[model samples]
Target: MKKSYPFLVLVFFSSCWSYSQSIATSPYSLYGLGSLYESNFGLTAALGTAGIALPSEEFINNKNAASLVNIPANNFFFEIGGTGIQSSFEDNVRKENRNNFQFSHMAFAFPITARSAFNLSLMPYSSSSFKISGLKIPIIDGNNEYYYLNVIGTGGLNNLDLSYAYRLNNKLSLALSASVLFGNTTDERTYSISSSTTSIDKKVNYSGIRPILSSQYKMTSSLTFGLNVKSPTRINANKVQSVTVENGSGSSFLETDKKSDIDDFYLPLDIGVGISKSFKNKFNVTLDYEKSYWDSTNQSDMYASFSDQEKFSFGLSYQKAKTARNYFNRIKYAMGAHYDTGYLEIDNKKIDDKNLSVGVSLPLDHLSSSLYISYTYGSKGQITNSLIQENYHKLTLNLNLDGIWFVRKKLE
Candidate 1:
């Protein structure tokens, strides 16, 4: 067979240096961090992102690093995925529709030794590209008088992870990883009076590094438990700005490309736990729960606030057997559900999300490679006088390929 790793490498490097487009267009992206993103890998997206306790034997598990230790000996794995989202936003006044497509992730993994493995991947950490025109804001002590503001925002952040896992024995495994977070966001605002308009342009650059720890224990031959922790971090920020004003009398520049210091963004601690169980070698189920202490970060946006967040997900899969004589019987089918009490609070209302997904994994040749296709439908926020609700449909495609390494050729 032809080599697959080379194609994966090319796709990987191209994605790393490519950042000219926005990954998210949600209006809520106008808030802090521009709508933080979690890029799913392998079968995780189809499994409602509940793979913290899954092994890396058949595919790479990006949720928990400890899963890497399960990589089969003398085997290599590569995965590339992308997503398409169609959404409708509704409010009391009007409705809008939009569509977006973007690459999700590119990752590769391999065994380092009999009981150890390593992985490297690049994906978006967050994205924001939004427009708000004629947003009326009441001026302080203005007695019901308000000013209309027009704003546009764009940009996001990217994350690069270096992970290593080691299996202490057949029942327990541990892993550690460090991730680099870097990116920038830009915003342009314009406010107008009867004869004059003022514009302010600002760009913020951010950079930081966070470390993660993960563990997995095989409680029984059919059950596995897992945990992962992400330490709190501070991302340094610098702002570049310019301001201009125009009136009937004249047009003038108040500032031009001015650089200044700003308060750094602080990410709160995050923790998660999960379990995976198998029954009769044919069916499997996985469940996960997670929490983020955003309230502790004490961060607030001009229009929103942060709060503690909670999330839960579960998945069920069916497969006749990995070695089933019939190709159809060997195919894997899965379905899952997810809920998240989002961290952002706008207008004193928490923006929450819920979704369901179904997928099928089609085996390729006799090797442990497969193609994954999944569909997800979800909604976020609630429709009210001050807030808009978003309903979205997402489709994901993942190409997972495998190869054998360090094997001596017999006929070549």
Candidate 2:
């Protein structure tokens, strides 16, 4: 217990430090708030971010808060994770590569009573970091005439969630969570013509609060069902701007340090459902589907249009019963796939994503502690005259630690 508290504190501070240095290298994050970060806690990432129906008997499940009620009594769980990605982006005429690393999430959960539990997590909600240089845009009405545009963007929103779950009966559990999102983004754009260049730099600040409701029902000893809903929210926004121009003449500041209220960003309502089934004692399967009503948000982007989005995830795992001598019996192997019909439409084309993952969890000790390692190969967008396709390989690593509390030492 003594060591556990200090470890938790260390993880908390470490996440804060990582947040300050985080950067997303995906070019597709240029729209809206940026790319929505998937906080795949524990081995969920290895399972293609499925498992909304899995219980928390042995490990933490951040997807469905109601699973917290399944946490073992007198147990304390903590998890932290990170990802490294190598990505390639290509279009009709250009191809480039990039590599980077980012922190995933930090979370901890503990039992409040025999039938209730509490959890807290820190994670990135979205990322807007992107870089584009000298993109040519043709004039709307002029023939064979074009203008050059350059853009650099950074920063994104972060989410801090507090969740509570209570078991209503032997087979049913309910949970509620409060998610606070706050962040700022900086966008710098430069436009150039024959002999003149103009620059506009602005920082957008955003803040919002969202509520999530979740439930889990154990239909049988080996089967479970889950559902979750996230209410729509309005994120207030403000911007600070500075503009400058440079040509053959000396550079001059047209505006500096101007601040004003901007349009609020509206989030779409999201809902998901999932099921899990175990085969014998060796194999488990989970399937999930989710939908987001982005069109209802009525938000508009200069380069894209919002539409309804759908996501699907499927996973399977194999584990053997514990054995005294064979260490291989203690490890678990998993594989899964995920697909998303993206919400953004560029030039009437759907910007979609699909991925496959494989992972293994190694036992750290006789207890529930484990080391999770996962590898994912994924792609998003498509090569078109106006769109760039992205392919990426991601490696994820996390440590999940379990501790026994309020128990006397037997050896001493």
Candidate 3:
């Protein structure tokens, strides 16, 4: 196992580099910071992304930082994951298909003491990738005839997180986390009329810090409750703009443009609560509710308005005895569902989303690690009100690696 670590690390880094360019291709990503990336890791992803109150000794729990306290002393845990998505978009008159593959996240957790633990991770916070074209409209002022418009956007935000967890008592734990969010986004718009073309390029860079607090309480031997809160933050942002023109003869020229500071973008507060119950190590159920106060931020972009958002998720799993020698008996099977009232409001219509998922975890190397795979089918938006409907299928693969570090060997 030790000999394979280096090879695995090499593969991980190479995959990360290859997919760093774009993580999403949905047209809906054109709004806001793009489609927000899911923070769930492999185990939680298999459970329908609803593991806030689920405690584990073998896997890192990302939903609630406080759960890190459950890590065994001197043990180190690591995970690397990726996702592939195939999506279809349809309107009243047309349909389009798109696909994307990218690295999801990389993280590690280790115990500091019997009752304390720490974790560090890097993952995408959001993503934006889209292209749209509008019908030609007559331009009265231009010497040309009718012209059509095309818009394209690409880029996204990334997050680096550090967290600490401490057990307060036998039944309670608390945690704190700090996250750095930074990224750059580019938008390009072009107009073509009478064989001549003009385009505007806009780029924005932003960075910010957000703090999170989390806690967990063991209500009973088989049940746990969890809560988390994220504070609002202001992101410093700057924009640079340029324009270019192309003649009918295919000659093109660029004009130096302006750079300016923009108003600080405000992110809203978020809160979540969850509960999990286990049935004698054979069955488990978890439920979670989360809310974001986007309306409280009172912020709106040029094309869309922000509204309060709510999400609900439920997950169930069945696991056989790990002590069983049969490989199939030790496997875990899970299924889950999710619903969200999204944060974006366009043309007075609210964009909503729903999904269903199922997954399995396969033990590897005597259970020291595991391979998790899940599939999700979902839909977003509505065809009415000039909005497009998006139907998507997503597949996730996660490799969890575990090892003991800093443990003193007993002298013979």
Candidate 4:
């Protein structure tokens, strides 16, 4: 335990810095918020699960506001969940992992004036937590701990959005929402050399803001269309520095010394369409197509740069009327798929990966309780570039809980 104290201190105290941004630069800064939520089953069912324009009817599906319109009137909603990632790199050289938990959304919807309903929600717009570790065996020395590198980071971007929906005719509904995003990130790392009591420690801190617009249109009782446009955003990370030591006698610290431009670049653009059909109100099948505009993002101050091609996806669900104990609600089974051309480019070659997942959801009475569990597997195919060709597989588990509190109204 005493030997590991220095490494822990290095990881915790190093993340204090800032950077600049600009519009002419790449909008890749948006990727820093965190990995989007993708269920193992959802990856196989749709395009990254990012283009959901409408909400679900049984509950607030987290995909679109349109799904909220189907919710029972005069009821509130809330949701919370967490995800874990266990990843591996090529040749077993690099490994990244993390376990994270957060609240997804909290909102209440009720009739305002006429046929219109308004919902105000506090939810996580984005989030990310990942770690990387590598070990090197000395060719000359036989030390058990020759070389080690450890990187750790944790933070999230969130937003408060206002949504409204109006029932036009019987078979058609339209909805719109506006959201603002705010979040920050902190990263720390330690590198040790072989045959010497020397090491280097680094730290970084960053923050930013973004605005988003989303909407959905229902064409028929069994079909719906979704659309979302996220404007350009900029993240500024400043006060970067590096610390080096030799023989544990003296310490030297140096500032990163790089100046940044603070401007906004359009984040990736996303579009998708979905169709669902119900059989005797017992079971339903849903299919969708999504396109992500990674080309719009040209640069990033926090991560590597690349051209991410558009991706594709699909999904299916089975629901039944079943009862459980006080904690259990209705049970639902779901499966999905997702594919994307990675955003980073090496040697002008595009990187890509695919995902597969399955999940189960439980609806708790009017209180709105739910639980979903999924796992994902991804591999980066060889690109045209000549660099460290690496591929990885990630396992993710997500758990969620949602409920509402009424100050004056009667319970359902």
Segments in model 1 whose C-alpha atoms lie over 4 Å from true places? 1-20, 138-146
Which tens-of-lDDT digit does each residue in 1-412 have in candidate 2? 0111111111111111212244456666777898888888778888988988987576789889999998788999999989888877766555676777878999999999999999999999988866556666667645788888777778999999999999999999999999999999999898998889999999999999999999999999999999999999999999999999999978999999899999999989999999999998789999999999998998778667789999999999988864445789889899999999998887777889999999998998887789999999999988766577889999999889999887788895
lDDT order, best first, reads: 1, 2, 3, 4
The RMSD of every model to the true structure, in order and in angstroms, is: 8.9, 9.1, 9.1, 9.4
Task: Assess candidate 3 and give its TM-score to the true structure.
Answer: 0.89
Which window of ten consecutive residues has the lowest lDDT sum in model 3?
Answer: 1-10
Listed per model in order, the count of residue pairs whose N, CA or C atoms clash below 3 Å is 0, 0, 0, 41
- Kindly indicate the candidate among 2 and 4 with the higher lDDT: 2
lDDT of each: 0.84, 0.84, 0.81, 0.47
Count of backbone collisions within predicted model 4: 41
Q: Across residues 50-125, which tens digit of lDDT does each residue of candidate 4 receive?
A: 3364346444444555455565554554443334443332221333222323333455555443445566666654
Q: Which of the numbered candidates is closest to the native, going by highest TM-score?
A: 1
**Where is model 3 more than 4 Å wrong at Cα?**
1-20, 133-146, 193-196, 245-257
lDDT of 3 by residue, 1-412 (tens): 0111111111111111222357766655766777788767866775668987887776778889899998877778899999988877766656766677889999999999899999999999988876656545556645566787777778999999999999989999999999899998899888887777899899989899999999999988899999999999998889888888888577565755579898778889999999999998899999999999999998886667889999998999888876678989888888999999998887777789999999998888664488888999999988764467889898999888988899789999
- Measured on C-alpha atoms, candidate 2 has an lDDT of 0.84
Error of 4 at 316 (Å): 0.9
Residue pairs in clash, model 3: none
State TM-scores per candidate: 0.92, 0.91, 0.89, 0.64
Clashes of 1: 0
List where candidate 2 sits over 4 angstroms from the true fold: 1-23, 143-146, 247-251, 322-325, 408-412
